[model samples]
Target: MLHKGEAINIAPNVVHWHGASHDSRFTHIAINPNVSQGGAVIWGQPVTDDEYNASRS
Candidate 1:
């Protein structure tokens, strides 16, 4: 897990999901660069209960 002052870079076309923890509050910055195709970001579906619970393990 990423602690305070740490950062992670998500490359283009990569699939990733993140959000606030159930027991803590935090903030983060996500920057997606515009590619030659003119697309910068592609959002996916919301996180389901099963998905979130499984990830916590």
Candidate 2:
């Protein structure tokens, strides 16, 4: 489990996504060092709650 002030490393091409609680405020600082090397972010459609829960099992 992640605690406050902890961090993790994620490499390229991973299926990871980010989110926040419905009533909470949050922020993120993203740096794309790969931008100059022809790297681009891959975008996908947002998954519905039903789809997310189904994947959990």
Q: Residues 1-57, candidate 1: write the lDDT tens digits.
A: 878898888877788887866666668687655656676677889877876677468
User: Could you tell me the lDDT of residue 54 within candidate 1?
Assistant: 74
TM-score of 2: 0.54
Off by over 4 Å in 1: 35-37, 48-57
Q: Mind giving the per-residue lDDT tens digits that candidate 2 earns over 1-57?
A: 456676676688786777554444345455668987876677678968876566446
User: TM-score winner among the candidates?
Assistant: 1
Q: Which 10-residue window in model 1 sums to the lowest lDDT?
A: 31-40
Clashes of each: 0, 0
Number of residue pairs clashing in candidate 2, backbone atoms closer than 3 angstroms, sequence gap of 3 or more or interchain: 0
Q: Which residue pairs clash within candidate 1?
A: none
Candidate 1 global lDDT: 0.75
